[model samples]
Target: MKHSSAKEVEVRVKRTFLARKKPTNSLIDGQVKISIRFHQLKVRFKQLSVELNLFNNQSSDDRHIRCQRIGTRLHIFILIGSSIILALYSSLTQEIHHETILNPSETQYTTLAQVLGDCVVCPCSTFSVSHETFISIKPIYHHICSGDFVSSAWINFLLRSQFIDFVLYSDYHQQQQQQQQQQQQQQQQQQQQPQQQQQRQQQQQQKPPPPQQQRQQQPQQQRQQKPRQQQQQRRRQQQRQQKPPPQQQQPQQHQQQKQHQQQQVTTTTTTAQSVASAFWSFDNNALELYNSGLDATLSGSPIYTTSFAGYGAAISFTRSSTQYVYITPKVLPFNSRSFTIEAWIYPVSLSSSNDYGIFGQCQATSSNLCLYFIARNNKLLCGFYNNDIQGGTIITMSTWHHVACIYDLTTMTQQVWLDGSLDGSHSASAYNGLWGNTAIGATFQLGSASTFNGYIDNVRFEARAKNSTEILNDATLHVYYSFDGGSLTDNGPNGINATAYGSLSTTTGRVNQALQFSSGPYISYSYTPFYFLGISGSSFTIALWAKPTGSYAQQTILLVEQPSSWCVHYLVMTSTGQLVANCWIGSNIATNGPILSLNTWTHIAYTYSTTNGIRLYINGNQYSTTGSFTFSGSGVPMRFVLGGDRVVRQYM
Candidate 1:
């Protein structure tokens, strides 16, 4: 009857319902279960409300605080949206740029600025970029990369091992052995064939004659057989007379020998066609003057002593027993195909029996052979793998001698030259098929192996055989006028003495003394040796020191002109005071050079070859080059005129 508030009434009703409940097992259990479930639901709702921060079913003041929190969250979300929109709008409107840098500076670049976009702003100077500019990469390698397993020493060790050496060279050795076995088998078969034929003939002759023929008409048969035998013998004699005599075959044999010689010459000439020449002046070092990359290494303290008569530097091997210069044969331009080796030697001691090496390449350490040039028995000797030639001229002790050894594979000849004269020569036709490979690992030595007790200088090597004229001249100095000793005598190896036609004086030269040319004067010499220069298209160098006080229109410094042809090679000064080197075969190749200062001593050098057309150098600096121009002429007579072209009346 007392109607309280809604809450009081609900609680009073729940209590009355629970108090009035009967003790029925099923109904009571159901009601209690429902009540527990209701309580659990209330607890779970409260927990969920707390987790969500909902603040539901609370007082006004609490709800007001919850409302304020919700409003603040909404304002934060709206501000985030506005910031995102502004960034998107700015990115869409702005032009994005990227940059690339190939080589970076060493300085470290650092920045603390931030960008909202995915990429950073490029520098002002850069408009485009590569991925490499921003991206970084690191490679992860296998463990073997940091080890020494791939070093050269390890590789060489493996190569030098016995197993590797056998594997590499076994095929070559087997091939050689098989060839020898085949040759022996062929010889044995030939011998056995002739023997077998002889045995068959003997067996046939040894058999007894028929018994019936012997008994029946022995005398009659003998008489008939005698006449038959006489007729057979006469027939045999006629056959012998019909055969050609040995004298008749001599011409054919001579023809074959000539053909063989021609083939040998052709072979050697082909080998000599390569123009590779090396020179070691021994002035101060063993460096190759030709730049052929054949520089040598000295061993065992060989002295770089004074030259002959103390003029220049020369290597002295007499001081030590095991001193020598070693040149690796692998770098030699030519092998045993053809070669020429020459050296100037001043022997201080002589031995009649002991062999002394001048410069040689031995076949091996055990076999002392294969291009072994030496001085033995007080004479020079040149040796090869198959044959050797010994010099006849005795080498005097303490005297300077120019020794040269030449082997021509084409001609099958070996020659030794002593002081530019032929000292020994012999046919090496035995080398036709017997010359084995002179292995590159062979020892190429100078002044060792029974030690050359001497001074050696001016050593030269060529891939081709040198003619007598070339042998008489220095390998490079074809023409040199020292103008010393108060005469126009040549200081070069070639003794082509010059004759001055007009007033010429000797003065202090760049070296010892120089030729001073006056107006209307020139020097002339025989040009026989120069014939090869034009025909063979070989290289030549002309160098001189000049002090000029004036310039003229086309003045000649040196000239080489063919008598009947217009094939002219001249070094001249043009009207513009510029130096010019011209070579005219049928066409012309001219190289213009810088003008030389007047009244100054200037060094001018001009070099010409078919490979290098024309090169002009002033004071050792190359001024100009015309690349390669091949020019050749008929082997006509040529005249060399110095300081003027007397034939054309052009003077410097």
Candidate 2:
């Protein structure tokens, strides 16, 4: 049993040993596979390194070959490019030459010798275009030190290739220069032509000696022209007797002639000065709108010279139906060819649809020659009717505005100036309206066309075409009234006295002393005819300042009445203590209810239009309104009676 057990143990140990051998062989096989793989990998690495080195050497040689091929190709390209460039250069040169042939001398370019120095030793064939050549083409590149190389053959060729382009633009620059020169020459010629024409005119204007017989003129004129003519005769006689050297006598004779010419001009001017003496400048404190020039005073003095003159006292006219200034018709020189009329005016009130006369020698409504302010359109009409009244200007009211008009009979041109600016111009084709009917008129008048409502200062009427500057700065005025005297005195040569109508009181005012109308007459039950205040048309506005003395029994502040004509325009009132406006037109009457409180000074305005009828405003704000009304009854001459109605035989 022990032997059998021992055999079994040996068998088991052998089995164990066999199993261990099997595992060891597997481990040895795995290690052998790993060793073979490492050897194969190392060999593969060496082979790869050898192949990599060979590829590197071949790539280096390939690069060298590529470089040689590229260099050879570049040389070929350069040769081909040179040929193409040469052909282009030839073509461009031909084209430029063709253009130069067509326009001839009209376009000229800088010659080759001008652009490049005259290098006779260098053949143009030696020129070749390159990057350097193009660099030279840049204008600023000229500063580079190319020295004489710029005149070399290739540079000359490059220039020749682009010569047409440069020449074409250069031709334009030349044309511009030529045009400018030509224009300057034309301007010079034009300026010289006028001067030459003026010289010719002066030469053609030489006049023959006047007739020995002296013509009729004013006393001042006779002395002036007579002496001037005698002096001119004496100068001519001296020129004939002196027999001086032609050279020396030329300047002396010219100087004397110039002086003599000036004297002659002064003499002729004096004749007009004598006539200008007929002009009326209201400078005196007289109740008359007098003519200091003609020594003839105006007919009626509804106005007076005030102490408000900037130069002297200005003429103050009370806007009245009966007051108007007039000069006798026969006094004006009818044969005078030209006339300048001007004045400075300050409009106290400018209402719509009213005409404030500035001055007139004829009927204002008939399109005759007249100057007036048309309040409807807010325009100044300097009317000179050859056939119809025409020329005018737009002028702002309330502020001081200077108005002037010039009538040149020779040219028949009428120019209107407002506030030192030319307003408009028109041609007067006929003479009958302005110059022909001088004797038939009632009188040359100032103020109150119907009624003029403003102050007039520096009134001027001269028979000469004077510009605004000349008129404003005139040293020798036709009529001048300084208004420094209490009585009317002629400041001009022709001193005419004017008649005073109504009594006007002087009071301390804006300047020296202003004419003051009694407040009782202004706000009480009295009314002035106020011809200038006659509201016309279907639409009108009434604006005024009123200080209430604590409303008195439905007091009528203002009223418009036409006596027995059955015409009533408005009746403004202070009812209780409230302000109200009532308007009547046609057969309809409208009321703009109570608007403002009384007892305090208030500005009340009522606008009446055919469309809206009536609109009431208190202190510039809308207060009440009314419906439309169509005005009729021959459009009565309605005066906007302030405070009460005492005109046209009516009452408060």
By TM-score, the best candidate is 1
- The reply for model 2, stretches above 4 Å from the true place, is 1-288, 292-423, 426-538, 567-569, 593-595, 633-636, 644-652
lDDT of 2 by residue, 520-614 (tens): 34321122222222333345466555544433445566656555454353654444555666654446565654534433446667777768767
lDDT of 1: 0.62
31-80: candidate 1 lDDT, tens digit per residue: 88898999999999976654443333455686676785576567667999
TM-score of each: 0.33, 0.28
Q: What would the TM-score be for candidate 1 when compared with the true structure?
A: 0.33
Using lDDT, give the best candidate's number. Answer: 1
